[model samples]
Target: MVIIIFHFFLIYSAAAVGLAPPSTYLDGCQPMSCKRGAPSVRFPFQLKGRQNESCGSPGFNLSCNNKNQTVLELPKSVKLLVKRIDYVKQMIQVYAEDGCVQRQLPNLTLSSSPFEFMSDYYSFDSTYKNFSLFKCAGEGWSHYGSYYTIGCLSREPGSYVKYTSSDYPNTDLFHCSRTMDLREVPEGLISDESNNLYFNWSRPECGDCEARHQGCRRNDTKPSGFECFVIPIKHMGTRTKLMISGISIGSFFLALSLSVVLYMHHLHKKEKDAQGKIEQFLEDYKALKPSRYSYADIKRITFDFKEKLGQGGYGTVFKGTLSNDVSVAVKLLNNFKGNGEEFINEVSSMGRIHHVNVTRLVGFCADGYHRALVYEYLPNESLEKFIFGDKGENHFLGWEKLHEIALGIAKGIEYLHQGCEQRILHFDIKPHNILLDQHFNPKISDFGLAKLCSKEQSAVSMTAARGTMGYIAPEVLSRNFGNVSYKSDVYSFGMMLLEMVGGRKNIDVKVEHMSQVYFPEWVYNRLDKGEALGMSIENEEHDKIAKKLTIVGLWCIQWYPVDRPSMKSVVQMLEGEVEHLTVPPNPFASKEEMRAKLPINRELPTISE
Candidate 1:
């Protein structure tokens, strides 16, 4: 009767605390398991507590086998061997036999649930300890892996122990920019056999339990959990509450302190890198600033080039005012150069040449690789703005503008070749490259790819080609196509002229549609049949100019560089009134009637959209 009354009293005490009956618990924790000797297994987790149905949350559930090895049923076809568990920190160490078979992957979902990952965006952790190692005789040397450390409450500098491979994409399964990262390794665990060694994992800080509580003692025999001390009834006083508050404050500050240290370390590295970049930028363009302007003036003139006009692949251009509000385009490079080659090149070319259709160079900024070239700012934008592609808006330049612009471009190219001491090849010539001034007169821009060669040299052997596709000379594709020469610029300019005439791109070609309409080939086909393109642009004078431009375009893109006329002759033709344009034979057509059409493999990279 006394025993029964004691049990009922214990039940009442538990009820007052909102504690459910032990029978309702998922942990069927035997009295022996509940003993202080047994390692701790907390709520939402247990040591195989279910009789037949089994323990814990549906997703986090796992069971211990007969010999005390934790067994996790990740899936019907998948199982991971749980190596160890840290109850105070809440983590489980498991070894997967092989990577999930992709199709039969385990579902470790926590979304809309209490458990969730730290990051919404999938990325490797910078704080987590990462390593790549090779097994002596293992399948592959230097096997790659990563692990993250987390801290619920702080204790010491090395107290946190990280968890990894807990969820999909968190481990090896991941994607980047709409593309999957496919791991390439044969089925089975990575093994190094020569030294007869296993993949050694870094030991976690979880060997000891959490710090500070009611008189806790370290349990060496159990080794993974704790032993609680009985709190004296008298000590649970006003002073006890204050003491507890102080400990909580200390713990909170400890975690905050660790974060502060990490952040400070990152800031230090950032400052160092910034200094290095500035120094390098100054060194690379060393010759430029001293020869042109003082450091004090550079700061004043640029507002430091801070008033940016635009940015391009070569560099960023800023608007600057100097000496009585004279507008200038200050070009600052995005990347640092090895030496002053690029600076010297820009200054040398712009300094020597003077033409009505060229943007004049005024000053330079070669202070380190922070190179910037100053030029006169044109009120009008690039030709790419006026015509090219399916232009929907109607600020129509019409035939008059196109004719004047084409003639101006021809003269610009002519000057680049003949006006300079040596022939200068404008490797890149496109609609976007054609700049306009206040008068809307076209002037060739972007001489970064310009190269100087003696006129006597019939063919210049180029190391590698640099130019835009659709405008890139055929010789760049293969030597058999043509010889790389100043005429290559003429070919690119010709394509630009045709695009202007049609008010859209003449090349309707694609990587997959290489066999379709090549601009030169398609134009030749149309002209040979004596048919107009039936485009939207119309006027008799415009039609006449379009026909002449097309014929000139065909002449410029001739198979052999030797066959193409000089830019001087091209200017005369574009500026001429009489119509005596000669038609050329088709070169881009089939070399033979029976041979298969071929796609050439060459070095090419896509520009960012």
Candidate 2:
């Protein structure tokens, strides 16, 4: 019986190893050279529709546009022409088709995409200067000769400020609708076409394999499924040699053995270090307020991971029911980089949080490497489905309900900032993270990117950028904006509020013209011009609510962190009379210019009935 069990284990291991498909399967995806002097396309970026899904993962698919030009689609529905793909550097140079890359700049958010803009690669041209395009509606400032006219605004009488030398336009003086960072600004100075942008990806599947003279193929044996397999020497090159000039095969084997021994020792030390961290976490775990469940309890509660609720970059969420008929959301964490920091973060933050606006943590499982968090089940799901989509019953939530939801969210954020023993800053605050209960009341969920600081700490230090791109504060993006503080969460909240008011994304791609693209900037222009809010108002109350939300949102989204209001102030503004509210200084106003428009004495302008 012992021999049979050993043989069964060996057979299972052998089958697992054999499950990895051959690199030959990827031979179909061999480098393809473009006819237009474009870079050779290779693994990770496969031609969509032409290549099988197995050839590339999500966000790695490429396609040819209507003009037969290769284009790469990014997060937030952004598409750029593929000018060059450098396998050697693992970077891609993209160009905007119309040369006005600035129009697409606001949409180049990568939080949802697998790619990132290359930080190291900037415009190498010394003569290049950053130019901005503002889509404004007002008198044509022909005297400001530097300002190029793009087109006329359809919603109002203003012409789009086609191009400008500054990002912060004199919005007080110029009724600018929207502004976006223009890529390849020098090109705009010369020609009206051909703008270049560079993007890089950190997905290791293809790049790492390529570096080792091997090819990557998708198989089910690994978690990510993509595996690196050895390529034949002949495929590497005819002139390539594997051996050192002075070393014999036997000597190489002996040296390899020694290296392996050293590597094993290093791994052993790493294991010990990991174990120490785990033991420390366990020691600290006893003090936490939340209930800790064993791995078996987690599996049993989740019914062997039967029903998956959803999945994201962090991990997959499963629907679970306790023995007492209470439903819960169980998030099984995966692809954690180190030491279970995310697990600790959620448990630590949510465990202490006890508010109606914030989601409650019912229990947690941190057995060995298996980490999961259980939260109260939210029946209505995320605010995104209701706010953005045309799904059944989602859009029927009246403007009043939307107002309540926004207020609940503001209260939740205010609680996070002040209610806790330590102030928790939720870096990622968007519609998707805002969960709605059965009554449509909002509860802020997902604290994966949350940072806890002492109540006395005015600013928090961040080594890398956190939060979603579209909602991320300008300060968090760069220190030049301002110090990272509780105000960062305020910026994200403002963006979310604007989305709720607009019933669309802030950086919408489907808008009729570039002038109407960024919803917030467009609304600001109308408000500054004393024009109607230009929304689909059902009645006077709906119009008032929409306008109120818009004004409050604009106040929250001030360009500088200091300019923005605190969550406490935001909640007050939402609950207070709309008549008492005032229009904020134009966020896009330039530093050189004085106040462009005088502050309005009356209430915020309402949408025309």
Candidate 3:
């Protein structure tokens, strides 16, 4: 009778808390297996934009890149590719997306994110590395072979830095740029080849609970936040002890009551906000030319979302046939976040675009937040499904085809940046976003993250970081790299091009041994040393295509936004001879401290609509 009463109380508590039965509500945290070599994701770590936020603790949200790699975005806009997550040890192993650890050190503060240095009740695998960064004028320390040489600081002309082990300078500092000491990092973590780093965080130890097949969560009634509720039958002993210590049934009931009210309120506010945002967007995009379709029309066109095409950060795609016998892809966006900026962006930007390389926006539907976009259906899917997929019989696109695809993507980007009346910067340009037609021609798609600005404007403003982890330019992640501009898109394109050349992700931890996980840096090292491009060369033409793509990609991904060439230059470089094309400076070699000044233009209106 007592057991039955206890079970009834639990059910009542769960209902009062507005939670599904434990089997359902807690199922979100079930270990998730990634397609690639990424580690299984579980408690305290959830894939952002995919898994529910409640599945993970605050500051533990992660994102999966198009390449199926898991990434963690830290404060100060640093993104580290997750190599491993040791649940028992509560440690996470990560490698810098770019091999430059020094560049990420300045922003590696723990205050903004939940992650903390080893000093904060956690232990690290290695000791900290202390290095000195010296800024000198005109490469005075050029003769020093031992020093890590960073090129001229962009802000201060004729100033260069010799990154070294000691704070004491061996030579005179007469012609030096401003020098600073980097944060003490794990020893050997900032070396020329250093790419992997580790961080640990304190979370409730739930291994025993998990072993016993029970769910664990924080004991919110506790003040220190260290206590947990090991759920189901396994934690009965702990519950008995807590009950004896005056953890009243009433307090738990009260918490459940409050949580229910708060959750309902949150849901109400979220729906209200989403509706208002959509309404405001409709008002702003009233001038948009894409004909708006009703929700019934969307259902008719999409045939009730039956034939699925693909999925992405924003939504899912389905195949549809129009009244005119034209095949179309209808994208139905998820409405839970972002204030409808992505929906407005697609309709406003792609509706006005007309180019063979750019995806044609056929129409849209925004009836009561049933947001969907219709586009001309290409027979072939995205370039990612072709190039980055497992090398099966159908996955291979030969070098000539790959080269043609690369050139087509370049032209599409150039058209967007230069040909548009108001230059549209497609912030997210990865293989997944690039669609291919039956003839294997490439078309730029997914303008949801696109930003618009006048042709004369040098840069656009942003409230938060946008774009995928591996492809985001240094500047877009943090202002310290340089001003965000069209060059940011170039950086993304460069990464994609490199992926095409390597026939793999640029940062594949499984293949690249040692600190050579960052493929761009590895390529730079080989190219600088005049090593054979390190690819399986079928013939002279294949070698030339690989070399050309590698060189152009290197040039496009220069660390500073200013150092990267415009899309127009990238196109020319791609078309030029492989021998004529010079390998760009190692993007990860050294940091460009100073940036060139550009004439500031009037601030453009916010792209809220």
Query: Which regions of candidate 1 fall more than 4 Å away from where they truly are?
Result: 1-291, 294-296, 337-341, 389-391, 509-517, 592-609
Q: Write the per-residue lDDT of candidate 1 for residues 1-609, one digit (tens) a residue.
A: 344444544554444333222222222332113233434453334445642233233444456556555555543434455554444444544554343222222232222222222211222121222222111211221223643222221123433222233222444322211211212211222221121111111122222323332323333456533344433333355665665556555544554565566667878999999999999988855522323755455567778657877876677777877877878777776665435555666777776667888777777765654667777788777888888534367555877777888889899889888887887777889988888998889888777777777766545667777788888887867776556777788888877877776666766654255633566676677888988855554677767877887888888876556557888888888877637777766656666621233334322222210
Model 3 lDDT tens row, 1-609: 344445555665555444222233334455564565679776677777767776777788788887788888887677888888877667787776666555776666545666544422255434555566767656344446556564332235566566666654545545654467665554344543445566777665655555665555544566644333344322235555555334346645555666666677878999999999999888757634577789899889988888998886688899998898889999999988689989989988998888899998989999996899999899988888776757454577888899989999999999999998999999999998899999989999999999888888778888889999899998888876666788889999999998888777888887738656888888878879979867778998998898899999998888777778889988888888888887676677533333233223423233331
Q: Per-residue lDDT for 101 in model 3?
A: 55
Local accuracy of candidate 2 as per-residue lDDT tens digits, 1-609: 344444544555454434343344435665544346755555677777677666666787688777778888876677878877766457788877766655554565555676655433542322345566666665564436556664322224645455655654444535665456644334332223336567677674467677777776666678876778765422322222232212234444455565666677878999999999999988776544577899899999999999998998889999999889989999988946556877888988999998999998989998888888999999989999888966444474888998899899999999999998999999999999999888888999999888898777667878789899899998788876667888899999999999998888999888898987999999999988978877778898998898899999999898777678889999999999899999987786784442233232312221210
Model 2 whole-model lDDT (C-alpha atoms): 0.75
Better of 1 and 2 by lDDT: 2
CA displacement after TM-score superposition, residue 431 of candidate 1 (Å): 1.4
Error of 2 at 202 (Å): 99
Model 2 clash pairs are 102-182, 137-158, 138-158, 172-596, 173-596
How do all models score by TM-score?
0.47, 0.50, 0.50
State how far residue 606 of model 3 sits from its true place (Å): 12
RMSD of each: 29.1, 38.0, 36.9
- Winner by TM-score between candidate 3 and candidate 1: 3
Candidates 1 and 3, the one with greater lDDT: 3
